[model samples]
Target: MEVTLLFVSFFTLLFIGVPIAITLGISSLLYLVTSGIPLTIVPQKMYSGLDSFVLLCVPGFILAGNLMNSGNITDQIIRLSNAMVGHIRGGLGLANVAGSMLFGGVSGTAVADTASIGSVMIPGMKKNGYDGPFAAAVTAASSTIGPIIPPSLPMIIVGTLTGLSVGQLFLAGAVPGLLLGFGMMITVYILAIKRNYPKGERVSFKELLSAFKSSSGAISLTFLILFGIVGGFFTPTEASIVASFYAVVLGLYVYKGLKFKDLPKILLSTAITSASLMVLVGLANVFGWILTSEKIPQMISNLILGISENPIIVLLIINLLLLFVGTFMETIAALIILFPTLLGVAVGVGVDPIHFGIIAVLNLMIGLSTPPVGVCLFVASSISGISMEKVSKAIIPFIICNLIVLMLVTYIPELSLWLPKFFF
Candidate 1:
């Protein structure tokens, strides 16, 4: 009865559009009260959940991402991407994906990538003879690459949850992320040809070099963070701090895009984003504690194992489940709730945790572009001034492309594991 009440309340609140953090808190509260558990456990569990040194990376990375965005990095990235890919059949679409890939290294969040890139790309694509829905679809789909690449906020959360090395998790995601990006590019190319999308004139090598030189500072920040973490120069937390400081220097002195006046606004935005995420984490921890008390994880593990102990079948089931959940739940909230439970199931079937982490994140990132509750879809649709239905219809091909890449990463462990092993 308690478990039933817990899920009912959770889904009810979630369906009614209560914020995820509050939904989690209220559901946990209902469960505690009905089960006769003391209310004091809430604060204690939340505190314990937030009381981790690794979590410090969250705010730092958020701040760095915000600082970079404020510094006009998006335009630079888009310029570089356009210079490289604008001559292709679906030039704007290809550039959209390429821009997302480049921006992913810095922003580390899909929403940021969508908003930053979509604001520019969606309109630019429309003006350049691309359909609004297609432009929006490409923007939303490619933004998933943000969290799959390095300096990823999702990977950091996975590291905190499993005590996996953040660096290895970052490396593990690299190949899969690139695969998804390139796969989307291929989809764009085919679609562009089928639909007769226009292509830009090829730029001279000199112009491409100029574009590269212009975006070099923004690009360098990615390498800085990656090499710093993998080279033992700094931990993920320290790398975030370094990234933030570098963003400041780039924005203020180097690019001159960020003004002193922008600092307050940027800082405020970071604080709000950070605070909300922390609250969600804390409340999610409380919700997780309730699940633990009810032996939910064990029950889930047993149920999945009972279906089949074969690793391949288990992974397929897990993938389907995550893909479904991703369509509804926020990525971090989903991670906090389901990842630990699923990790045990995966490990039981001899799947490596690092590889599974990549798989799980990739699933959720794709969800960010899917329908019903796909936040990126909403953002892109809004930017394109198109209906959600149109964007949804347009994004189908890209989603299929992403799913193909997801399957490859799922079956081939080396796609995720190779880089971490080679580097570490």
Candidate 2:
């Protein structure tokens, strides 16, 4: 009955278009009211949720991403990518994927990736004679890599929930993220060739050298983050702070692109975005509390064990459940709520949490490109001035490519574990 109320209220509020944070908060609050729990607990949990030292990474990373944008990094990345790949057939589209992958290593947020890259690439692709929907599709699909790479906000949230090492999770994500990027590139190339899309001309050696030189300063942001994290120079959270500071210095002094006057707006935007996501985490923590109180995880574990003692079948079931849940719930919300339950189950089955975390995040990341809620899809459509219907149709093949990669990460634990084992 409690579980029923939880789901009923959550879905009801969600159906009525409540912001995800509010939906979660209200649903959990309803449980409190009906069950006669003291209201003080709400404030306590919400405050506690935001009190994590690790979570400080979220705002720092977000600000760093924004600062890098202000520093003219995206333009440099695009130029650098074009210099390398523009001579090939379907090169510009390939450049979009490659640029986003490189940029993803820096920004670590899908929405940021879509907005930053799409703002540049969509029109660029269109001017080059690529159809608008296809341009938007390619941009949207490639942007999913943002969170899957290091300095990811969602990984921080998930790590906070599951007690996994954020650094390990970040390292685990590298290969899968690259695999997704490469898969998207292949998909775009096949489509570009099939439709006879325009190819860019080869640049002269001098032109290539100039583009590389121009982009070198901005491109260094990626190296900064990768070096800091993988080199053990800092923790992931600490690395975010370092990255944010580096971005500011680069923007203000090096690039001279963002001035002192821009700090107010940038700080305000960072605060608001950080506050909103933190609220969702707070609400999810409370919701997770309610689920724990109701013995939901135990019930779920029992039910799964009853149906299949085999670890393989159990994992398969879990993968499908997460995939469907991905279609409906926000990824962060899903992560906080499901991680506690699923992590335990996976561990009981002798599956590594680090491996599962990568697969779990990649699966949900793809969901952001799926229908009914796909934030990335909406962002791309808005940027491209295309309709949702058109973008959805355009993204179909690319989504398939992503799903194939998701399956690889899911079934093959070595892909995720190798980097962390060797590097960490």
Candidate 3:
């Protein structure tokens, strides 16, 4: 009866389009009322959930990303991307993917990547004579790489939840993230050939050198975050602070892309975005508490194990289930609601949590490029002025590329794990 009310109220609110944070809070409240648990637990748990030193990283990274967005770094990234590959057939399309990969290091969120890159790329691609849906598809699909690379907001949350090393998680995502970018690029190359996409003139050596020199400051932020963590100079939280500070210095002074006047608006935006995520984390913790009190993880473990004991088969099942759920679920909400239960089962089967963390984060990212609740998908489609259905259809090949990379990361743990091991 408790579980029934818990799930029913949650789904009801979700389907009806309540904000995710509110849905979680209300569902947890419902379960408490019916299950006869003290309501005080909600406030206590919500506080505990939001009170984490690690979570400080969220606002810092969000600030850095927003600052960079406002700093005119987008055009430099595009120029650099084009200079590297613009001469290739479908070079602009390739540049879209490459720019996202570069932008991913800083944005740490796919929607930001989609909005930041899509705003520039979609119109530019359309102007360059590419199909609107195809342009949107590439933008949306490639944006998922943002969190899979180092300085990932999702990996930070995952590290907080699992007590895994944020550094390890960052490194673990490197290969798979790059693979996702390269895979999409390959897809674009093939698509360019098939669709007869236009290309740009090859940039001269002087132009390439100038572009690289210009964007080097922006690209260095990724290294700063990774090296600061893996280099034992600072924690991930501190690294986020460093990332923001560095971005500020470059944007205001070096790049001249941002003004001192911009700081207030950047901070305000960061506060709102970070606050929403924190509130969702708090409420989701309350909902998770309800599920755990009912031994839901154990029940889920038994349910899944009842179907298969082999780790590979079990993993495949979990992957397919998450893929479907992700189509409609917000990534962080899905993480808070499901990661613990899934992690428990995976660990029991001898899967490494760090490896599983990469897989889990990567899986939800795929959803971000998917429909309905896929924020990046919506952002890209909106920019392209195409319907989600059309963008969805155009995105299929890139999705296939992402899936292939995902499978490689899943089955060959080395692809995700090697960097962590090599560095550590």
Candidate 4:
């Protein structure tokens, strides 16, 4: 009865178009009322959920990403991308992918990557004779690399929830993140040849040198975050704060684009985004509290093992379940609600939490690019002025590319874990 009420109220709110945070909070309230749990527990769990030190990184990183967006880093990145690949057979198309990969390293947020890079690159690509839909598609697909890379907000949350080291997860993400970029680049190459997109004039050595010199400050931000983590100088949470400070410095000093007045706005925006995530985290904890109070994890685990005890079969089933949830649910909400339960089962079967986390995030990130309510896809479509249908069609090949990379990361645990074990 408790389980049925939990599921029914949650799905009812979700399907009716309530905000994710509200849906979570309201549904959990419903469970509290019916399940006869003391309502005082709600305040405690919500407070505790939002009280973690690691969560501080999210707001700082978000502000940093916003500042970078407004700081004119986008233009510099495109110029650098142009100088490097603008003369290839499908240079502009390839540039779009390359630019997103580079920007992803800085922003640590895919929507920011897509909006900042895509706004500039999409129009540029079309002017250079690439198809509009293709440009939109490439931007949408390649931007998914943002969260897969270090200083990623999702990675931080996964660390906090699973009790894994944030630094280790950041290290693990580096190789697979680059692999995703390479896969997208390869996809663009094939598409360019097939469509016969116009080639760009090769950049001269002087022009290449100038572009490199100009973007030096923006480029350093990437090194700061990467080196801070990989060099053992800081943990992921600390690195995020450092990266945030670096982004502000680059914007105000090196770029001279973001004014001092902008700092207040940036901080406010970051606070709002961070607060939203924290609310969801609180509500998810309440909901999960309801589940654990009922021993739902043990019950579900026994039911699954009774059906099939094979570890591979169990993993496959879990993947599908997560994928289905991903299509409609926000990634963080999904993570908060399901991951605890899933993590328990995975560990019971001897799966590595870090390894499972990489695959889990990768699969769910794909959901950001998928349809109906894919926030990333919607952001790209809005920026390009392209219809969702057109963008969806354009994304098919890129989706294939992302899937291929996803499979590699999923099956070849070495790709994801190699850096972590090697460095730390």
Best by lDDT: 1
Give the per-residue lDDT of model 2 (tens digit) for 329-369: 88889998887788788888888999988878888888888
Task: Return the top candidate by TM-score.
Answer: 1
* Candidate 1 residue-wise lDDT, 37-113, digit = tens: 99999899999999888899899999999999988899999999999999999999999999999999999999999
| Candidate 1 C-alpha error for residue 132, in Å | 0.9
Of candidate 4, the 10-residue stretch with the lowest lDDT total is 303-312
Model 3 bad stretches (over 4 Å): none
- lDDT per residue as tens, model 3, 1-424: 8789888988999899898899998888888998788899988998988888888988899999999998889989999999999999999999999999999998899999999999999999999999999999999999999999888988988888878899999999988999999999999999999989999999899999999999999998999999889999999889888989999998999889899998898898899998899999999899888888889878889999999888898789889878887787788888888997898888888788899998899999998887666778888878888999999899989888989888988999888888889999
Query: Could you tell me how far off, in angstroms, the CA of residue 187 lies in candidate 3 after the best superposition?
Result: 0.6
Model 3, backbone clash pairs (residues 3+ apart or across chains), number: 0
Q: What is the lDDT of residue 144 in candidate 4?
A: 84
- Give lDDT tens digits, candidate 4, residues 1-424: 7678878988998999898889888888888888788899998988877778888788778877888887888889889998998888888877887787778777888788888888888888877788888888888888888888776778888888878877778778878888988888888888888989888899899999999988888777777877786787886668777878888888888888999998898888888888888888888888777777888777878877777767677777777777678778888888877787887787777777888888788778787887666777888888888899999888888777877887777667798877778777
- The CA lDDT of each predicted structure is 0.94, 0.86, 0.90, 0.82
Q: Score candidate 4 by TM-score against the native.
A: 0.94
Q: Which scores better on TM-score, 1 or 4?
A: 1
